[model samples]
Target: MPSDPNRKIDIECDVAVIGAGTAGLAAERSARRAGARTLLIDDRFAGTTCASVGCMPSKLLIAAANVAHGIHGAPQFGIHADKVTIDGKAVMNRVRTLRDEFVSSARESIEDLPDGAKLKGKAKFINRDRLEVAGKIVHARSVVIATGSSPSIPETFDGMNNILTNETVFELDDLPSSLAVIGAGPLGLELAQAFSRLGVEVIVFDEGDAVAALKDEDIARTLRGLLEREFAIHLGVKVRASQTGQTIELAWSGESDGKKRFTHVLVAAGRLPNLQDLNLASAGLDLDEHGTPAFDRRTMQCGQSSIFLAGDCDADVPVLHEASAEGAIAGNNAARHPDIRPSKRSTPLAITFTDPPSASIGAPASEDTIVGVADFSDQGRAKVEAKNAGMIRIYADETGKLTGAAMAAPQGEHLAHLVAWAIEDGLTAMQLLDKPFYHPTYEEGLRSALRQICSQSQVSFGPDRDEGSVPGV
Candidate 1:
């Protein structure tokens, strides 16, 4: 293969996938399994987003920070010990060591693809049915766009290169003494809390009042208070930053005013889809008002039947699992001689890896839904662990079917998974109550919320009712 963009070489495949990230890898594997002669293309074969930077690495760092935090707070258990010291460099090295293992595992999964099955190049649409990649033209029956996304750095902070995003933050060999994290979204909150626990003087600024896109107001408020006790949180604040000699100066408005300096600034504002180099207009696809390609979220199909999209490029959901599911749907549909029936979408699950993690599953709060809440302040397991600091809120439809849930509590990630599964399986509040829960466990809080909802339901429950029976049995 030549680097020259003008050199012409023609290749053909039943399915052509762009970008070798999570969604692209999934699409390529699915398309091949569907019997398509798939050609996977990307400018680089770096590991999937989760393994490389997004989920896995962040969680590793959070795990290390949590250990340090636990030791510092160990006196609450009446176990007096010597002062705990943290080695920032050693902690980060451990995170990187484990992160590299995850990335290597992901890379190994696709290493066996045949020589001609994959191409390294930046691909652009020659048309709906063809793409130009590494000076080679690929003609394919169906095309999948899985270019993923990049950190969204605003133009105002263009010249200062010391700013960190999730993409680069984990690579730090030594932690900064002070950090100013802009945005209270999952990435921002998770990293802020992680660093704060590891002894960084963290200051968080979010334009929105909520943290991690939490829908339940009470949970959001509780989370804000909990995080504020650990770090300086300035919510509903508009922030501007500039490099000031050896430090970064942050000026904000809203709850507070004036300027502060930090050793480093982290911009976890959001993400932008990697769409610019695709030349999507050549394929006759128009971008939406948000500047993302027009695609049906349910089917992951672009405006043209032959073109499809998955993962961050779709811009509907950015989680790794959601991207993987969308990739399967897009790949199956693209590879099928005549398109198969559309697959059902998975229940939405979002988790922030902060201490007393916050999570939301399925639909957000709305007028039609009944809400139930359980505070962790008195939760048995949480109290025993000295981690009782938040709450769990569940929502059900008028008919009592579980619809959604939001939680800011210890082991919330596990609870969110249970709620998401139940909602996906169409379980009702009463039905969820029937499932056996261990005594004095974190799940008991979830059961309490379910009981509250069931008690309020117009339909009576009975042992005779089946697993997903409606409110009245």
Candidate 2:
């Protein structure tokens, strides 16, 4: 038999995964485990975003900054340090080293796969069931898109020389003398505090009224005020930016209006899904108002088709854990297409790493909801450590079941998890109060709020009225 002239490959796979980020790796692994001939494809072969730039690298920098901040605040405990300094080079060296280790671990997973099960170029859909990668052709029963997202930069600020996004900020030789951060979201606020505490004059700007995307007006107000004392932050107004010479000038129109030039500007405004290179039109997927493919959130199925979408590309919940869970759903379902089964998503939870970290779980309770609040200033443990600041709010239904909670308190991350578990288990505020809370601990603060909630919730379990919802995440 003679070979066909148009044939580029004899590849036939049960699943084809695009991109090699956290979600893509998960999908490929899951599909392969399900006895499918999965072909993993990636352009750069980089690892998870958290390990590379999003979480680990940023937290490493925050850890160093917090150490410097702790030494400066030692006088509160009647302990004075003669001198404190942060070695910028040393700080970055550690971040890069640990980050590389994570990337290397991810590479090992790819290396374990057979050579025929992986592809090393960009893939574009040639038709409904076939893809053209580089110059080769592949036929797959189902496709999983996990290309992830990239930093979103405003068009007006394009082609500027002094602009640095999260993608490029960590590569700097040393911290900038002065830095201006755009966007007061989680990523922006985290980096702003890190830079400011490390001796960089940092200012943050965001048009939104809230910080860290907090919906509870009470918590948002308190957290914003606390963060303001730590560094200069301007919110609730548009920011004007331009480049001149070797620096960038930032200006905002508001009560705190001023134009200042900075050595570099970090843009954490938002992230855009990485779908442009895939030529989505060839796949013939149904598009929504934004020209994005319409898909079921629970099933990850695109327009009742075999193709699945996952991770940051869907922009549903961009957190790392959420990405992994979504990947598993898309992967497993793709292995058995046309028989999609909806999977229940866990109770929504989000946290922003700051001095007194901000956290939110589930959604706000209904109109008949009873709210409980705990002020850290009055808490025993907080006062003893001089970290007494911020507030925690818990919302319960009339039957005393915990619907959601929000906090900008010390150790809010741990508190958020405890609340999430209660919500997941359908435990009422009264039931949570039944559990013992140790003395003088931050968890006690949570119990304080739960007690307040139980006080207002006297009715028995009943039918629903309002479906609580979370915003901006």
Candidate 3:
């Protein structure tokens, strides 16, 4: 088809997705699967930070840091390392290369969309079922608001020029000699560990009880111990103010003492949605007091049925996986329109990529008689690789059903996926115990944890048990 230059190029689609992020991409894919014409748009590059600057680049840095740690500590594994040094600049170069590769791949994916799928520049809502993109008005039967978020910067901080957000961290050519990570959430802790291992003087501060505050206490305690033992951690501390005119001036108050101190501060507190630029009021939508789009949970529909919310822009958990899941649900339903059916979302599987990495699935915490542990020290492969530094914990009910689980180890991220599958599939503790797991693999840790749980259960309800022996029975 030849270009229609004089036609204003205004297009129509069954569904129009506003962000080309993980959720937006998943939504587009689902829309195509449902045979809907989908048009995806973004203000910057189509893909969000996870692909361009956030998760992808951060994990690359983590992997490089881990390699440096392993090489520097090789003597303990009976390997001779007469010379062990990490070139910080070189490591950062590799991180940049990897991030560029991801950006390229994301661009290719967007360009390769099928005929029914189209990509465009900045899109703003003109009215319900209508959006203005690149000076042209496009109409859709339904719209999906997947516009993602950005780092939330404190207004009191004066050194905005020196301070950097997750989106800008990957652009650094050299690492800072000393870094003060302001928030102790997953992002803060992850970066602190990575930078500390890479020879940066890292001081992490958290006003919350601990990093990953929403996680279980035991996990938080274990992670706190690991970070404190390896890096500097200051909990229950608040940054009163910061000035970046020359040396970063940080005014902070610690919990125990009301005394204040000054230091260089790096703020990683949290993120706010990118709602202002969208001109949502033009489409008859208003943000809640918290500035998030107030929408129906189940349907994700905004004030108007044709406008659906997805990703961090909405009030759901700001996880890439959750965003993608919501995007697909919202996109598919919008594309199908009148014939739409209810979409179901299973429990979210997530992880914190620290030195040991922490993975979790299902409810926040599990209270059951059946608890299991699999230390990395016992894993034959981890032992062989000399990376035995963490453990896997599992919780189950009285019926031997898997409830919730978490793992801290080099394979924490990978192992968490399997546990997530087991929990989501409703596999009982005994069933997982019987399932075959390959030897000399991180997955063996799963078998080890379940085996321990079985032994504990057996010991509790031993062979000598009689019908009248236990009060519960």
Candidate 4:
């Protein structure tokens, strides 16, 4: 007899991937390419965090703030302009419009998949190799868990209103009269500065004294000083919030304690993975004290089982590039199951999108590594741009391999990439110095820092000496 049309059915595939976010999409594609019948599942077909409400929208807001900032600072260059006005509604409208385009592009990839290969529903593990999606059963030889993550609201924020996370902040119809940003991390500080520049009365509060997780003391101090010039930052304290009518009252206790009220509070503390509904216990994997399963980060595998974990689920590195790399690794491994491929992760690189910007690359320095310093306060390019408030430190091992570096410098994003590439390629400071260094450029600051490491390591600059180069010589 034929099966009833109203009844659910069981389906089988070589691989089942949970979540269709950035990492999940990559995993599904990679698994299919490896000759596996793959199934991709998501709670909803929303675009990636980067395109939907994270990087793209945040950058759009920053771009608008930068234009207003430039106009305000034009007088320093002896340039004058009439009164500048920022239409908050128009700015947010453009952000949402362009952001939707990016999200639509990401959605196209999943839409192109066969209807049977994609399912729109939450996936729960019935067993090690079985997932129950809606009423249908999906049995797979291997499974990849890449559910991504979501904004983590504190317990104190429960039942609270007018609180904004990175995901919800971009949806605002217009800028608020005031914003209280809770956290001095990258996300918090970036938005705090952007909103301040765009005429929002902003105050940042953080339990930690430092900004953006920088390890270097000097760089952090320099960055904090520069930022303080723009707005207030209260650190070394825990802030409690209470709603009062249309305002949110924030109270903090520390060296300097005070209470301030704002129209809204932005919680940029961090993000947590979405795993509550997965019913992980059914997988029967050995779980950690935190309930996370033990897995090899390099292979993205969970113990000896065919199940794999990737992306923000591991919470090891939450950056987009790291997510993509981990997704590919997990996908290929899930497709090949009992025989996983060798995986080599690249050097770590991170950037904070501040006005002058800040970046960190590779690992932090140990006592044995020599350090090189550059003060962009005297940098020609920075002075010319009127953004001379910056510093950089380069770390190299005794053998001169560029191990790590930290910077609160202008164009540090580009500098961090160069340093990361050099570290990844095992290029020593002197070897990198052998390359060209343009005059009157921000990269010259990098050369300055590299020279210090080379000098400390007794490595000589052969030819094309940066200092010897003269214009029109």
Candidate 5:
């Protein structure tokens, strides 16, 4: 409803949800399911980061790039063809076409809601139990903050209109002839490789030693080496950029102290929570040391009993699945009368979609953990596929429980999911080894790593014998 400047209208709801992204949508559904009269509010665009720009669109581009890469590498598999060329404009058109479909689907979900359930305006906290949205006072019993986040552009590139982020990079009609990608995080690496494969001269710069926030040092080193072979990578360096007449010039120091020119620059540094205009002080909440409202990560509850924070707004976990889970928990709690309890969290899993994908799951390797290694260079399926260039490392505790795993290999996503499930189920290395492993498959590499972990474990598997036989028999 449009705001009336003269007077404010009073609306009542059992639960109020802010933002229209994945978390907010989930929160609204969960609140309604819990028998609460829910109101969802979003001032900005309707589509989510994933559907619009973050995950789906980026993957669409990567899929096109992968096809181009496959055709070029077909000769190694004895499937040679001439004139393998990529049309940058056509590739982007396909990405945008698919991306729009996903966005439309997401928008349809919220658009189908009942009348008065969704509001199109920014909401501010008038008081602990009241919100000012479009000059209407929302008297909600409970509130959920799922406002999400936005890309964090470096202060150094403040006025550079040509700099592209994930939000704008996908909108490009034609790929740049040369690109400089700042920040070697997941988004940066994914897009960098994708552009390079599509015939763009790409260079990636990171202030950190590792890319994609990889926890395992060995796996990070291996992945870095592989990426360096494809694109010019400068790690552990300070990068400076300047405009030089329709061209972006980048200079860095560390392994290389040289300046290079690029047609465009993409900044994939990080993200900032969308919380500044929420007027949180009126709700009796203050930003914590991290400049986000203090909340219990397990419960998603803010200091105030009636308010809860979830998703990127809480800054606990940024992945889509985590956001949905948090929203469900927050919504359920918000709909309840009293006595809010904490919810169980899922096992951590991260993936990077490079040619040989990188994946990590569960707790990071520590001193209390035993490490097992398997090189894909010797794995059967990887050799057969001619993509044998990475390794898998699994970690187990002293008692043989699967602690964590990291892999930079073919089908790492599937392998990571398997490991994450095992870890979440509290399975040990021996139990994982006992599972059936198909012959000559990429999963066999996972089996090999588990076997190594079992060997290094303190727990002993007594008398290697068939399970069909009894002890007395």
Candidate 6:
């Protein structure tokens, strides 16, 4: 197949944004709004991994699996079905359709941006403020590197011919009968559960003792329960060796008893930054000791003030939302030219769409404050909806200031917005509790959790009484 024609352009802009993923798109819009001439460049003309292969494709498959699981397991809910089977080919076709829709919709939004900014084939730094794009050289006052990441798999194990990662997973037409997912983080767990629900016998392995180690323990446990009910879990394990056949072979280092076992493996480890082709040394930008762009967190200016870094390439935790947020800041900083005022608030909220879903907002809390929790099983709405197993946990300071909120429940995605609002506004637990919440709603669970913490805090420490230290109260 012939490659797409390079849309050549030789021009100068106030801001040149690289990578047209979530962050790059946001940066271009923000820079244009700030009255800066911006140019956006990406390797994928239609969509990159996140658009075509990563997020969209995975979610599409997961959605189908969820529906299939619901129908297959409906007998317990008193809903009768003769038999339920998943058409693997049909599922993959639907995923392709959704992916195409994403590219179409994304293009419409991209076209709405300022007409001056051009989306080119590829972008690489020639000098500090100069970039080579699509056989044309362009200069800008400031450049933002928003190039995203690609899936990374260690080469210790063989059989990549059968082992699948996020990049190649979408290319699969038929589901594996028995599959082992390496890495029990968000991606691994999500895919494991999705495949299990789709009737694939799935297992997950990871170096960590539990999945989603960075999340709150209670929330992770709840999500783990849902996954365990569907898939086998091999924790604190490493891929040692592998051999492929009609059924892919694998060997792993078990966490307990230090035993090595064999199984069929699927690699869902994580992503590595895409910076190999970009000659950063020419622009005087070098990777930090951490292997990421060494940039001032406050300014996002890498090496020099003229070149800004954004997205997963510069983030401590990589995600679409965080990338876009940082990209906006970078674009605004880029527009400011020489002198720039950076944002003080840099908190990130993340969500994992496993079974009931898991979400977290703000920084974690010290062990001293009481960690208030409300189970969704106690909520009237969840009980009625038959999704009452998850829990909501909130951390608050002595003065009732919201510290953090984490939820493992159905509609946790919706609950996250309220938590984000509370954290952003610095709402007190008493204030949040007193607010009128609609009865029998998932959000009412939020109000209930805050009220419980407020009541307990008041009772534990009387008015004008000095409180002694208690372990999370």
Specify the highest-TM-score model's number: 4
Q: Which residue ranges in model 6 land beyond 4 Å of their true spot?
A: 1-10, 111-116, 119-121, 256-265, 344-347, 456-473
Query: Taking the tens digit of each residue's C-alpha lDDT, what string does model 6 give over 298-325?
Result: 7677766598878887746677777777
For residues 1-473, could you state the per-residue lDDT of candidate 5 as single tens digits?
42332345488899999998999999999989999999999996569889999899999989988888889989887898888778889999989999999999999989889898988899988776788887678888999999999889888787865799999999999888999999888889999999999999999998888887898989998898998888988888888878877798888898668799888899999888999878887788767886788888777888757899888888777889999999998998899836688888889998998878998888898887898888888777787787888988998897789988898888888988999999999999888878876676888777667666766778766687232311111
C-alpha TM-scores of all predictions: 0.94, 0.94, 0.86, 0.95, 0.95, 0.88
* Candidate 6: residue pairs that collide: none
Quantify all predictions' global Cα lDDT against the true fold: 0.85, 0.85, 0.73, 0.87, 0.86, 0.74
Residue 428, candidate 5: C-alpha displacement in angstroms: 0.8
Could you tell me which 10 consecutive residues in candidate 1 have the lowest summed lDDT?
Answer: 464-473
Backbone collision count in every prediction?
0, 0, 1, 0, 0, 0
Candidate that would win on lDDT: 4
Q: lDDT by residue for model 2 over 1-473, one digit each (tens)?
A: 32233566668899999988889988988788777789998988877788888888899889999999999999999999999888888888887888788878878888888778898899887766788886788889999999999999977578887688888888888888899888999999999999999999999988777789888889988888899898888987677778888888877886567889999889999998888878788889997765567888898889978899999999788999888988988998898887788999999999999989998899875688789898888677887788889899998888888999889999898999999999999998768866776765888787667767766878432344212211100
Model 2 score (lDDT): 0.85
lDDT of 4 at 143: 97
RMSD of each: 3.9, 5.4, 5.8, 3.3, 4.0, 5.4
Ranking by TM-score: 4, 5, 1, 2, 6, 3
**Candidate 4 residues 168-226, lDDT tens each?**
99999999999999888889989999999999999999888879878888888888899
lDDT of candidate 6 vs native?
0.74
lDDT of 3 by residue, 149-195 (tens): 77887776744455766877777788877777879888888888888
For candidate 5, report its TM-score: 0.95
Better of 1 and 4 by lDDT: 4
lDDT: worst 10-residue window of model 6: 464-473
In candidate 2, list every pair of residues with a backbone clash.
none
